[model samples]
Target chain A: MPKQAPVPDELSKPFWDACNERRLVVQNCTACNRMQYPPEQTCSECGSEHNLEWREVSGRGKVNGYCVMHDSRIRLLQADQPFNIVVIELEEDPAIKFLSHLPGTPVDQVPVGASVLVDFQEVGPGQLIHEWRVVG
Target chain B: MAPTGWFPTTRNRSQEGLGVWEHRGKVAVVGIGNSPTARRWDETADTSVGAWAISAAQKALDEAGISRDEVDGVVTCPQGMGSPWAPNPIPEDFAKAYEPTDNPDDGLTGVSADWIVKNMGLKNVKATYHTPACISPALCAGAQVVGDGEASTVLVIRGTGNFSGRYGQYGAAAGDTASGPGQWTNPWGWQLIPQIAYGFDQYCRKYGSSHDRMAPFVLNQRKNGALFPEGYYYQHRPDDLKISVEEYLSARWICKPMNIYDCDMPIHTAGAFLLTTAERAVNMKQKPVYVLNHVSQRAKVRSSVETLDETEAFTDSIARKVYEGSGLTASELDICNPYDGFTLFTQYFLEGLQWHGVQRGEAHDFYAGDISVKGPHPFSSSGGNNGNGRTRWWNQLDCIQQLRGTAGERQVTLKAETALAGAFTPNMSDWMVYGTSPD
Candidate 1:
């Protein structure tokens, strides 16, 4: 099976569109001035419905945590077996973290709290996914 | 500690009434039943969704000495009945029989209250199905129905042939066919195993815990599994009972920070609990376990925010609410059946419930003999999901058995006068405390 692609809904379209352009974006609440991932219709912090905006974020952040997958439930993920999945806490807002794969980083080198940069890859015809790689 | 009194408050079943501790304990679990875990190859012509459900329900009813005609209320979880890959012998998936007319989702996406009434061949009954929460929701719903005078006898049933039926595995097919949030996780290689592993990895980072620290919890579960004759690992893989730290670490890692032992063994099984008013249960054949409290809560936020908030997932507030409602402290609980979907959950729950004031960073004696059936504080003596069968809400069944003093060799030494059962899944959490006798 091909890699699992997220079925972007109306609320998440802009976030995916930005990812398609190799730019990382998240929903920034105007009221609370906080960033949210996995875009939702309403601002989770302030409950502001009308002022939510998609803001591009500098995807440089410290690794909140990570896991090295030696086996995957999905066969596609196992194609590149023994991969690393990292949760990156974006610098724009430390609370706003994104879940992504650490494509090229070795298991031991994928350190928790290490600075990382988001890198984009085209996994399908029109689908693009963001990955994280450790940076000095 | 002995079980608390029943219905400490006056007759009021409204939102305000919920605050009153007396509103609870009016309902009791009168009967319990379980079906053997099956494998993919164990399918027969009769193992349809309806057949499996009927088998457990019949057993529970027989234990209660209540006939089909006596049941006035029914609650069910059909989450497992839909897998097209499983050989469900029923003519069609149960969802198709009564898909909500309003909802757009089709196929086995939903199960209506009418479906259970029809399939179980029961007469006029107040039936509600498809309100799927983790197994605890059905228990809470069943208890409330009897307590509120909606029904004299309520039957709560949960059956999942998912493991044997759905591609002979715990998870569904990946990629394009993936359903729910699972599809979203796949592209990032965030399958269920790793996603959960990350939860523990984050916890370890915050609390400074290690594989060695968590190892004993898994070992304790395996030890309990050996005592549980029904556990698949106990019966088939007897060697699992003797797992060592070296064997656990050397085992091929499914995900970093988590080995094969950390994951729950998915098996095909079904469990049912029969609930009725304390008055009705007085005449029942078996001992009635009083339902002290059934409280559920959801996090204020959803998605990544909640997922990343390691503390929120196992918030102390969840346990505080249960303790406040049940009027029972951690010490008062003779037995606690915390959700063990993952072995790591044991720590999350122990800390969340403030069991012995155990904090996130405090050292826990998971290796103490008290963690076993004969110990003072036995955890999921039925081996939990770790070693026992992974039937949703199976912990509740174990709690009932413990309180009824029918757990056989695995029964807790406290006489199980007061027991706590908690379930945490995704964004939702629920807890219920049971007692041996009414106040």
Candidate 2:
């Protein structure tokens, strides 16, 4: 329920911006040609501090794994029933370590290798985060 | 905000087997002590969990034939994240913080195994902290302390309430999206546990196992729980330990198969292991217990974290590494206190070592019987996590009493050549196989 952007630092600002714009953006290091999310200034792979830019991915990925959570706060946000969260692998993206919320209609039905795209929800104003739902 | 996935990785397990002890280390465990396990201590009491820990520590020191002042290093595990609904949050023992100050010579701190090495301020005095659902890893920390040599003698402490009650209850709101008493709520990352479970369930399904069959495994675990006096659920031995798609938890199932009993209880008790190296143990006035061996494993891949990796299995996950370190195999073990936070956890090991070639199929008739000294493989004389309390105290105490031959009526006649202990499920367990020669 944070009113202001909880985005604290310069390095992580892009992720928050993408959330506000409803467009999921990732950082791609031009030097190593690698794509990363949770936008780090430096590349974890090859450790190059080279040209990094905000690049928009297809916003689609495969469910590498998924989890069902029953959080007290989650109840306040949505239904008191089971909801799915997942780790997804972006298609043909470099620095491919992608982890985020999987927002399918039902958690039980989230399948491995299930094709998914990012879906955003507004819990608080000026704040929208991406959740994934199964597509094609 | 969900904490960023980046966590400080555990101290490298890769450095093990390559440490100095790989050659010259000759450490033998000398003493161990634990508080009696009980259900629900009144937090509003004069006797605090801190007091319980000190009492156990005193008994451990007494058993080790060492003086508290003689200790030069210490090891401690952080108290469990106590209940959010509890009146007093984080029932910390200022006493634990004070133990180092009280003793002065042997104080230690840091996260898991790293503490022993850093604070005991010795090149060799090893120390570490752990949270492996229960006490087995804490016990393993005690062994690592002795083996790594942060202090000539190391004291390992595990405890929580009676002195502090509210801190010992599990948050009911977890898994349950509702605000009901039976609903699930986790202020902590506990909700992540369900996700982990789902990940594991997916693994099981991929392997063609169904939830109906998994229920029997869980029910068998509940039965084992029926034997313990202090276990969270002491009376009911559910006839079936099965996993279901319907999700039988307070909240939408926190992952399939893992139920309330399958989880370690929020506890108000203390357990400690006081260890002295063989050389120092001899000089001390106390007759010391010996540690035969210790083993540990970190995940090789970003493997499933919520449940046992169905493919690699818990036993194959680290048992052989520990078996080699402890110099034991299924054949040589006399007692086993495998980390049984959940049922199939021990069975996972049972399946891997093929405890008598036990296999993993949908309907493998798996029931744990007391393998006595008189019988083939005398295992978990205290009912593993099931029969014994899941609190880590049993893990250490089981090995201690076995080595000391003080298991009372439950004592096995044959002197145990090896007693294996671990915290193998859902985390990197510090597993060790202890040996005994009652001379």
Candidate 3:
């Protein structure tokens, strides 16, 4: 089964567009100079709706926190049993981390503060999502 | 002076007490009631969401000594799942017994405020419905309507039957232009458990907290739940009550750094609270629990904002306003009940309330003290949402009970004194302080 895909709208179209191109982009509030995630209509930091822009990010972050799903009631997720769902804190902004499944990593070896790089995988037709891999 | 109809910005001493805050002593919780909480597998026709709410409302009204005719305002905090007619697609099995009436379009969703009012035969009542049920907001709404002279009595009702269906049945993270599970989190395989596990993970990294340090707080809740006769775990699953660190550690992990016991028990339950003017409360049948302060507001980041470090200083605003508005300190509170849907929230809110002195980005021994029913500061004397059934507004119920000096075996030492209870949703935090009388 294909991986879970997000339903994107106009406010989030740009971020998802960047993902299809294998680029990590986030919403930058021109007013507050604060970067945010999961794209929004306005800057959550400054409430600026007019000056929002989609900007590419380094896509490198440290492990903020994570969990290992030993079992899932959802059938589609069961194929990737015992996977690690990591919340990565982007290097550009500690507060702007995103959620992604970290495949092929030993659960015990998962580092809480280790650096990681973002990569994309096709979840469905013409659909690409950002994922994380540990970096030395 | 407190605002007669609306609260002013500055603090003022009023007839109620210091810093009456607009609603202080203006609205009183004259009655509290709960339907027996049971597992979904144990659900009966009587336990349907509507039935549970009606039963609870009847009891609360009975306790208040107010007839249905007296209720002019009804505030409904419906479950997260959609109404029976157009039910949520995810929890497909839930409310299957609910058959759409001949007039499904009449807007009488069984859980809606209008339906509740009609069912109770309340006359000339203004009904307000709060979508995506979270009980705290309803309590705050009820207090506002009555305190502002909009109505004399308001009935706040909330119930959840998710246990019979499933969690995440309604999806996570709400947004506009996008319906059904919002972006980032769901697409990335993140749900409630993983999301919270991440927050606690960050807490551990910054503060140096480990499993050992966090277990005591959860254990304190278990102990408190054990003391309550009606607690689901203690009563039905008696053997599960005496959980230890060893047992907790050995349990299978649903999410990293969190075990099975770290989460809340999912059970179907309904609760009702009756709000009336303080003067009227004095004439009621039950002990009056005055609404000293009701503060509900957002923190720095909206809950919808998907971020890695969401927990950092998120509850700061809630803490600041609750302390300042209520004119009470952590030490002054005889009982404290924070949202404990997840044990992590209990710890975070405890620290936010200054019950513990843990600094940000640093960890301390969370289990160092006895934070039990007999502890220095009694927290969740009714076992909270963790040990108790997730009755949605159990915090308020427990707070009212403590302040009324009727908590029975789980009674707090400072009964009939100041008690603080908090409610937390994804992006917002609200707190309510209750006192036995006008201070």
Candidate 4:
């Protein structure tokens, strides 16, 4: 079976669309001038729904933490067992974190606190999802 | 302290005043009942979730010497039918046939308060509550109801069912499109284990802790579980209970920094507690374990999983509130039963509470010492869910039993007058302080 693709909803469609274009965008509150991710209807910082706008980010982050998956509950990814799942703390806003497999990174080699750059992978046709890669 | 009748507000970090715990010393846990833990649905035994729940509740009521007619309130978690990720629905025919009577209890997927009242022929039930939270919160709610004079006696129960399959397997049947939060994680095959593994990873990096330091805690819990007759390991896998440090160290990694032993086993089980006013508990059969205070908090997670800092703050808030509300200090706790659903949670709870002066980021070091039932501070003597099964009841039950002097072989050698028990995770969790005396 193929890897699962992200099913975009009304709230997340713009984010996925931006990913398809190889851009990383987060919700920025005009009132508070803070960023939020996994796009919410209302700005998480200032709670201003109308004041929220999508802004492209540097796609640069640091490894907050990571794990090596020796076992997977999702059967589709079992063949890729012992993979690395890295938590990327966005440089734009450390609070806005993302989980990425850091594809091509060897298992148990996730460098905590190391810088990373966002990259997109197509899990399904026309469906690209954002991931991260460690920067030298 | 008289009944102030004033609701205690959240105290500032100063932790000075004895906040009015409205239910403190008012509600008493008089009896506890647990069903035999099973690995999965036993076709041979032919038990239903409803049957287990009712049986556990009945055992509790019997121990309390309280008739079904006397129960005035029922509080329960109604969604323990199967794994939340992937549930095995009860067959329509079996469900219908199982309960042929009018207002029949579902007894398969879940059991509601009304169904329990009806199924048990409870006569005087005046209040009913169904909470999706864990067992600790359910009991806390029941105690609050009784303390508020809505009901004099209440029954708090939880039943968990397991179907035969690998736990938490998001089968291909779940489809190829990850929705909502999964859209971000599932596409990368990042699931619950890895989510927690991230937290542990952060803990190890920040605090200089390692899984090797966690071996003694795991081995201790397994030893305790082996001795606990009511637990799953004691009942089913007696020979496997003798876990060693070598075995624990060599345990296959479910996720890095977390061995298979770090996770609690999901099982088929039910547990119930009977609570009444302290006034009524005096006339009951067992010694009353006073409900000193309880704290429930929402997780402060701005992302998919809570950061180590967020979890620490969350648990610290709970600990401060519990101590202030109960008018007790962490030093006064005779036993500690932090939730060991995941072994890391135990560390979070202990360090969060600062029990016995265990400083921040020092729980791993604290576990390096003697933490057995005979230790200075008996930690998770009931073996918790890690040693037992994922019933989420052992910690509280052990608290009651320890305070009541009925823990048998698992009893702490110390005074064991007061204990702290909690459930779920450090981020989103509930905790209660139990005492031998009301004051």
- Identify the leading candidate in terms of DockQ: 4
Which segments of model 4 are wrong by more than 4 Å?
B1-18, B44-46, B84-105, B170-173
| Model 1 interface DockQ | 0.54
Chain A only: TM-score per candidate? 0.89, 0.76, 0.91, 0.93
Error of 1 at B135 (Å): 2.2
Q: Cα lDDT for residue A134, model 2?
A: 76
For model 1, the superposed segments whose C-alpha errors exceed 4 Å read: A1-3, B1-18, B81-83, B86-115, B163-173, B176-184, B233-242, B300-309
Lowest summed lDDT window (length 10), candidate 4 chain B: B1-10
Candidate 1, residues B256-359, lDDT tens digits: the string is 77777777766656667888888888899988889988766555544453353645454566677677777778777777777777775567677767665565
Candidate 2 overall Cα lDDT vs. reference?
0.50
Q: DockQ of every model listed?
A: 0.54, 0.19, 0.39, 0.69
- TM, every model: 0.87, 0.70, 0.86, 0.93
Worst lDDT 10-window in candidate 2 chain B: B180-189
lDDT of 2 at A64: 70
> For candidate 3, lDDT tens digit of each residue in A21-119?
999988887878888776677787778799888888888988766777664544456567667777677898887767667665676567878889998
Predicted candidate 1 versus true structure: per-residue lDDT over A47-121, tens digit per residue: 889889988888798888778888776656667767777778888777776776776676646778889898877
Error of 3 at B256 (Å): 1.4
Poorest stretch of ten by lDDT in candidate 3 chain B: B1-10
Residue-level error in angstroms, candidate 4, position B246: 0.9
Kindly list the per-residue Cα lDDT of model 2 for residues B89-202, writing each as its tens digit: 422443344333222211111122232333233243323344444455554555555556555677776664422333333433323222221111121123445544554565
Candidate 3 Cα RMSD (Å): 5.6
Q: For model 1, what is the C-alpha lDDT against the true structure?
A: 0.67
Window of ten residues with lowest summed lDDT in model 1 chain B:
B1-10
Query: What digit string (tens of lDDT, one per residue) describes model 4 on residues B1-439?
Result: 1111211223112232448586789899998898777888663324666778888998999999989899998888777635541244445554553443232334554566766776788888888876665787777777778888988999998888776767666444256778877776787677657767878888888888887999889888887887688899889987777878888889999888788889888888888999999999999999999998877766547876578888788778888887888888888988788888778667877887888899888988888888888778678899998888888889899999999988889988989889888777776677778899998
